[model samples]
Target: MKKIFFAFIVTLGIFEVHAQKEFQGMAVYESKTSTADMKNQMGKNKEITPEMQKLIEERMKGMFEKIFVLHFDRSSSVYKEEEKLDAMGGQGQGGMRMMSSMMGGGGTFYKNVKDKMYSVDKEFMGKEFLIQDSLPQLQWKMESETKQIGGYTCYKATASKPVNMSDFRNFRPKDQSKEAGKEEKKETEKKTNFMDDFELPKEILITAWYAPEIPINQGPENYWGLPGLILEVSDGKTVILCSKVVMNTKEKATIKAPKTGKTVTQKEYDEIVMKKMEELREMGNGPGGFRGMRMGR
Candidate 1:
């Protein structure tokens, strides 16, 4: 069995280069999180209710939605869903509304915000790192510790940023009068910080593991660039793994970069977007109450 496993890994190392290569493997990681409710802002004196806890749990579950085993070679991407999402408006208001409806509004908005607000990628040092295009910042660091998963080795990395639970609040627009509605809409338009509340790995940990023999940057989601193939990844509370790995299959694996958008370096695009977001936030204040949802924030 050990020899069979060894041969399987060796086969994967050689032929998984073609985009079509069917390299089978599993990736894993842990997920931990905290949730806050704006409605509960009434304060600590109020007893915590089971209903609220359920809501929080449901929200947390959604926040950890990407936990799963991913299968792909150099040619495909673990975040194929996101690739498809790019066709849906590039994370703008339209994207948020679509996501909120699919996730079931309320708690869903907060969770979805965190998921799309930022992008996490594996770094040149083989460590998982986070990019806050919203904040236009990038940093990499080692995670908490290592673990053995499904006969593979793994390492952990964490970031020291701040997490804003306030993002959990629902920002839909609310207007009582017809004139008020139009006035409010025009005033709040373009002032929403829909992306600010939903960044992942704010003061969180991430783990990534690669096969020492692969010597290529690759992993699930946006993670890549390790000495070997990454088998598992996680933030302190959420985990995702590659469950089955088939190395060096009959077909070849080919990888390609995304062709959409105004092709710019990640850093350059982030800076421009971050500056734009800040300008929007400063220009106007969005609705104050649970306003009705708008197409763009």
Candidate 2:
């Protein structure tokens, strides 16, 4: 597996040199993260009402059920949401509607597999940010497994990533007060942090299925550098599957890198997003928490 990992990395460099002869195509990936597992796990929490738990679980389930497009021409590609909303709804309405949009928007993500660099066009609240960083160097262990997706044969590969529960900040209830924050944290810690596995596993498995027929080392998100194009991704709770692939068309793709926004690395962007959610939590808690959902503040 380690040998295959090193070989794939070297192969990416070779593909970069022959980019002029590579195929240019587009793929559509529909992502759906199951809520059943999380819903069952949320049942054990005593601090949250059944109603609030259900709301949280449902919101999370919807967040990942979005559509994304990947336009790749050899070493470079852009992966971004299909439904690019022009305006965030109900901005001054001052309700969960605005906050929901704030928490729900999945930003535009771009990757240059040859350079091993990534840029994400993200909008938090009203502020825009350009998240610039290198792609994660995942050591994927090739498995002697195969699957067929959209008529293309795919091979399986798996790797482990360090788990951080803090990444799911949008799903967390807005902090209303200091006491409320502690109580909220205590409750979440008791039953598992926003889902099962709050105990913090050293690492979580990331499984990817890629089709060698498509020679580009690109995928729906920042996942690339594999021997082929990735079609499916699984992270225990969330699963993103490719439903369609379109190639060799007369369509012009705008796969350019985003330039406008405050510049920040991936880590800095994450910190900014999390901080905004925390502020929203306080806002929601201010006037009796999300229309009587009981923020535990």
Candidate 3:
């Protein structure tokens, strides 16, 4: 009886050690936006022929489809795009690179749920910015819906997120009422500003599917605050889905937040981007630029 008791105590100690081990995981996600709407919108334009539309579609395809990897521990995670070479063996096309900057791609995002803060290393128009901000408080409404993704059972949760009007992904064709058409004609007569017609919805609904078995509150991009790890997210136009998940890899990921670049809050970062875009527009309109280029014609 004494020998059996000693063995039981040793077994319990080993189990405790295993239980205390830090949990780590890596998730690969494939993000893609539906181009059908964009194509349909562009098809209405008389200037864009079928061949030109196809070329634009191909370019936009590269901009919309991206792969991201999330390396996460129990309390923190780092998410970044998986770099890939372009067709011509260079980094990417100039147009694609510009689209990436406009879409805020190619950034290292770090989130610490325990500390209730997040940081991002973003480069825009040749300027690097470190955006440090508090985690957004999403009032998620849990649903009874369930689905299987990559062999894991995921539950649905949803919330409303404020839309950024400047994001091209959120752009929708505005309904042209008779009164609005008259106003638009008047503005056109006055040579309306190129940026005046761009519009996006005020708010967007976010749907996320989280896997409770993972038990981490981390997610791709700026999404979080769920009871489990978010495996998939959709914001109407774009969908990010987990393609693979590996648990407890041999090498633990370094989950340090980015420290370089000009530090600014998220709001300030948005303001800076908008201001720069405005400046560029002014420069383009000034001298020997793409002066006739306009949106919402």
> Which is superior by TM-score, 1 or 3?
3
Candidate 1 segments whose C-alpha is farther than 4 A from its true place: 1-64, 67-79, 82-93, 97-146, 155-206, 211-216, 235-240, 249-254, 279-297
Q: Among all windows of ten consecutive residues in candidate 3, which has the lowest summed lDDT? A: 287-296
lDDT of 2: 0.66
Error of 3 at 291 (Å): 9.8
lDDT of each: 0.39, 0.66, 0.75
Tens digits of per-residue lDDT for model 2, 19-73? 5545578899887665564455456555457877666554444355678888888
Clashes found in each candidate (C-alpha, N, C closer than 3 A): 48, 5, 0
lDDT of 1 at 295: 28
Clashing pairs in 3: none
Ranking by TM-score: 3, 2, 1
Candidate number that wins on lDDT, 1 or 3: 3
For candidate 2, the TM-score is: 0.70
Q: Give the CA lDDT, 0 to 100, for residue 29 in model 2.
A: 86
- Tens-digit lDDT track for model 3 on 1-297? 999999999999998767545668899999888777666655654445787667555655666888999999877889988887775455344435545645536778899888999998877656778989898889999999999999999999999998653356776546657347477565456432323433577788999999999888889987999888899999988899999999887787787899989999888987886676678666754101223222111
Model 2, 8: alpha-carbon shift in Å? 32
